[model samples]
Structures are given as C-alpha cells and as structure tokens.
Target: MTSQFEYGSISSLQEIQRLGEIIQQCFGGSPNDWERYLNRIGAENFRVLRQGERAIAGLGIYHMGQWYGGKILSMAGIAAVGVPPEDRGKGIAYELLSRAIEELYQLGVPISVLYPATQALYRKVGYEQGGSFCRWELSVASIWLQERNLSIYPVSPINYTIFEDIYNQQAQVNNGNLVRHRAIWEQVLEPPKEEAIYAYLIGSENEPEGYIIFTQNREKQESAIEIRDWAILTASAAKRLWTFLGDHRSQIGKISWRGSPFDPFLLLLPEQTAKIIDRMNWMLRIIDVPSALSKRGYPMGLEAELHLEVRDDLLAANNGKFCLSVSEGRGEVTKGGKGTFQIDIRSLASLYTGFLTPQQLQLLDRLKATQEDLETARLLFSGSHPWMADFF
Candidate 1:
C-alpha cells in the first residue's frame, strides 16, 4: 500500500543520501556519482516527499543570473525530479511539484525553470515552451582548414588567466552564455581522471583570440570528440580553430558542437550534409519583467511596446501586466494598463532570445494575445536565435 507524506522537509545529509539511493535504484546508478552535483546544488534547495520513514520523490533547485545592466537573483532551476517506479501514476510527482513550487514562491524565487524530459508534462504545471538548442555534426574532411595565421597550443596552468580573460570577453556579448564562475572552471577543466577536459587556446601575435574545452569518448571503439565550450572573437579565428580540430580528422571520426541555433558552422559546411538536432537546454522566466526585458540588447531600428501579463503562480509581483518600450538600445517600462499585447513572463523570456516569435508562441498557446497584439509582439520580440551556451 502507498502512503502520503509532507513535502520540503528533507533537511539532513543522511536524509538526502537515503533519497539519493532511491533515485539511484530507480534510475540505475549510485547517487554518490552526483556528489559534485549535490555540492553545487545544496541539499537545502531540494524538496522531498516521504512516506513513513522511506523517502520516495524529490526535486532539486539551482540558481542562475542574467548579466544585463543589473543582476536578477532568485532565478531558480528545477532538476533531478523523480518518483519510484512502483509509485508511478499515483499523482505523487504532481503533488511534489505543487509543494515545491509553493515553497519556491514562499522563498521569493521569482522564476522557476527546468529542462523537461517531456515538454508536455511541464506544460500542465504552468511552465511554457522555450526555444531549443541545435547540435551540429560535421565530418573533419568536409571542413576546409584555413592557413594557420595563429598558433594553436594546448592549455596549461600558466596560461589559464589569459585564456579566461579572452573567454570572458566573448561570453559577455554572446547571449545565452553562462557566466562560469571560477569553481565551475576548475571542476570542468581539471577533473580527476584521464578523461579530463582538454582545452586549446588560439594565439595570434602572442595574444589569445579563442579557446575550446572538449572531451574525448572512446566507447564502442569509435572516437567521438564533444566540444563542451567554444568561443572565438572573429570568423577568421573560428575557421582557424576548426582547422586545428580538422588536423585530428584521421584519428577523430566525428566532431560535434553545441551552440546558438544560428551557429555559423552550418553555413560553412556545404559539401557534406550536417545533421542538426534541436534540443531545449535552458528555460528562462522574467523574475523582473521590466528589468529583465530592458537589460537585454535588442536588434537596432526596432521601436515598440509590449504589454506583458506574467502569471507567476509562485511570485505575486510577477503576476501582473507591465508595459515595455524600447528604442535605440534604451528601454522604459510603465504600468501595463491600456496595453496592446498580453503575454506571460515565460513567453516573454522565450521571445527575448528571438529564437521563437510571439506568433509562434501564440500558435503553441504559450502566449495569449489578439491578432494586432500578436503582430506587435512579433515585431518587438523577433531577433536572431537567442541561446545561452551553458546550462547553469
């Protein structure tokens, strides 16, 4: 027989360990493998559903920031949601979601986002559809390696500081870029294994121009190299960087890259058919609609106003409408009374990146606006693919 339990009371490390074991058993591994994950996301951020002495269901929360004019906090992210197989279809997961969302609301987290394994499941919980990421695969032979104007060298501890400086500059302008703290860099770049992350820095005139962090997988006797992070300041630099990767064409059979939906690599490869796979990585919501919208850079020569009615089932302040106006890289916000278009905050975030249009979101029922309002929203929110390179 199944039992009922309260949510959000999993406090101790022991309790978390017990819950982790349940996850491991159901999902096929020991939770100890996620120690780094647990540390990054503290146990206090998790909500657990316990029946008697046994923990059954749980969810994790993480924090992220959007670097605009000012920083927005309390951007909570949900992950590692699971319920035991025996307890499936009993509405346990749904109840846990409700309780977790309520707890996040109480904590004053303005936005809650998740990368749903199934998009339909989260929609029922009031999370809307966001834009997706594209994974591109290209054969090394297909890429024409340009003359190496710059020297490519392996990353070393000595040049870590210079590499970071160059990376930070690229990350700032790159929308959908994750702000990698020092801890994240240490964990990703210097893990404790032979399969540790490999990094390469491109130097021009003794100065760094680009860098890439990647790892090799040798499973199935086939060599597959996955690029974890890649950034170059110029197109020529990008070509030179890929040319370096092409040098390993004989040994490395396949190369995969993940980035914005408008990645230029797709345009570079004309001879071979590059496979593009669309997968949603990050889901963003406007914690402060006016501030979040106004902070992000928009396409030039576009001036318009949008009335956003963001329904924050968790946070009350974000549940109302606000008028947003932008022109010449400046924006203003007013009370959304007497507005032209109405959209939810989640929809607004999806539109923020220009990967998905207001009309497209409207068709998906993610945005609710009239025809004229939809046209206005489409005009203001449209831009090149907006994507964050990292999933924080």
Candidate 2:
C-alpha cells in the first residue's frame, strides 16, 4: 500500500511482456498481446503504473469521440484497465486513473468514458453511470416484419460510404453514441482474416438509408446471427430490416441484437419470444464542464438562461460558478453567475448527459436546486437518455 508507484508509458519489450502477463493474470489476455496492441496504437497511447521495474496496473487511452447534445465531442475511451490480483486493494488504479484523466484533459478531450467493472473506483474518481449497452436474444420467427416496397441490397466493402452514411445518421439523434473514427470503419470494411462479418444497405441503390452488419456462428445444427452494427432511418425501414432478419428463421434458431438501449424490438414483436439477455452500463466523466456544455447539441427550440455552481475535485479549473445561457437551441457557458445550485463533476456529468434529470439528481442529493432552478435546469439539459452502442 505504501509502494512508490511510477506512472508513465511502457518503454521496452520486457515491460510489454510483463504487462501482458499481468493482463492475462488479471483480465485474461495473451502474454504477447500487449506487444501487438502497442504496435497498432503506438506505445505512447498506452500507459502503465510500475513500482521499481515491476508493473502493477495498466490502461490504454483510445482517442475517441461521442455524440452528445447533438454534436460530436472528443472523448478519451479508457480501455484495458487491469490490476494484478495481488495488486488489488492498493491505490494503483486510483493513481493510474488520475494520470490518465489529467492527460486526457491536457489533450483537449472534453469528456472521458468507459465501461466500468465496478462503480466504486470510478465514482470516487468523479465518473457516473451514463447509459447501458444492452443485448437481446429472440427466436427469429418472433420478429414481426411489415412487408413494404423495400429494396435491400447486399453491400460490399467497396461501398463503405453508404454504410457510413447510414451509421452517421443514426448517431446524430442518439446521445452518448459514438462518432466512430474512420480507422475503425477501415477495419470493419477490411476485417482481419480470422473475422467474419457482412454488411447490407436498404433503399435505392444511389440513396441508402439503412444498413446492417452481422456475423454468424453455428452449433450442433443450430445457428445464430449476431448483429454487429446496424442503423435505420425509419420505422418502415426497421420493419423491413427485421423482415430480412426473419428470412433466416428456417436456418437461424435465434438472433442476438446489440442495438439502442431503447430498442423497440419488443414492441414490434407480435408475440413474447424475446428475452433480455444482458445489460451493461457505461460510465462517463466530464473533463471540462464549460467545454462539454457549449459543445453538446441542445434542443434548438429550447430557450433558457441559468447559473450553476460546479465543483470539481480533481480539476480546479472547473471548480467555480458558471453562467449558462441558451437560445435558438444553442448554449453558451461562461465563468460568472449567482449559482442557483451546486453540483460536483460526477453528478453534473449524469445530468449533463441526460442520464439523470435535475429532479432525479436533486432527489439523490447530487444536484442542489430548488423547484424553479430544477425546472430550468431540466429544460436546459433535456434530451434523450444517452446510450453508447460502442464498447471501448
């Protein structure tokens, strides 16, 4: 517990080998996986916490972005947060997180998000649960696909633009969704030799509004379709897509969908043949309060003016009163105002992302506001409950 932890990027193959073994022991990965990962993302993007020459914990910093308030905000997606079993109960994770967040803010990332294995450490570090990554399993026959004049065509990697266009359209209306980097799409279009994924587009050949990518696996004469990524522009298109999924019912016993947290598949099902299989909540932290507020998209018709007293423990620059004025669906955040109520970085993130409304936060004692202020904040921060479809 009293060990002097040194925090920095991994420097050598020996350190990479050591970190990989620790990862295998802690989270299960190949001993040499770190070497390959470092090669892909570069050594500087990965960090480690060491005592002397021994690594105790490590994490990777992914330069990512997410859709929030109708705009894409730069995000630091924390990945591979691992601590050796023997290193647990120590402060290594806290130390590593502190360094990672500081670096993210310095790099001008307005927000940092991650899928937390546990809420305690992240909450203590000023992160809050934002939205869930949900998956559902259903019998292929259960899908009620409404037949329409739908032209669905298979898409080849050569036509990546159509797929990206549809995906981009979906991300816009959904808060906390990812604004994927082109490198990711490049990989998707040209998956590794060991990967099997397929894509398709719907609508006119020149104008595709919906897309789906899926992978299949078989077991003992039964087959399952795992939807990798998909998006639709209309309910009719969605129904048409489901109809396409239903086409495999003769061969596919089940289909698993990892889509919007608010997926209406259940409502679309004529019968109760689907089950909620899994759900995982992703955490988000506000790195720069003013920046996050100003950059996020808001309801264009919403007009409001408010004051807030924000408190940030790790970032002193965010610890002060902020004046938030909104008009014509845009917002401006400044540094002075008679704060109506106070909120910490953690709680503020929840409210800012629409994961929790002002009333809910006040009831939880996370947001301090009266009836009027709460209503104003509610209107100012109103939007869909943020959900991230991507897992970092």
Cα lDDT of candidate 2 equals 0.80
- The estimated TM-scores of all candidates read 0.81, 0.91
Which whole-number lDDT from 0 to 100 does residue 336 have in model 2? 91
Query: Which model scores highest in lDDT?
Result: 2
The local lDDT score (0 to 100) that residue 107 gets in candidate 2 is: 76
| For every candidate, C-alpha RMSD to the true structure in Å | 4.0, 2.6
Error of 1 at 97 (Å): 3.2
Clashing pairs in 2: 69-297, 300-329
Error of 2 at 154 (Å): 2.0
Candidates' lDDT values, in order?
0.66, 0.80
The number of the candidate with the highest TM-score is: 2
Residue pairs in candidate 1 whose N, alpha carbon or C atoms collide under 3 angstroms: 176-387, 176-388, 176-389
- How many residue pairs clash in model 1? 3
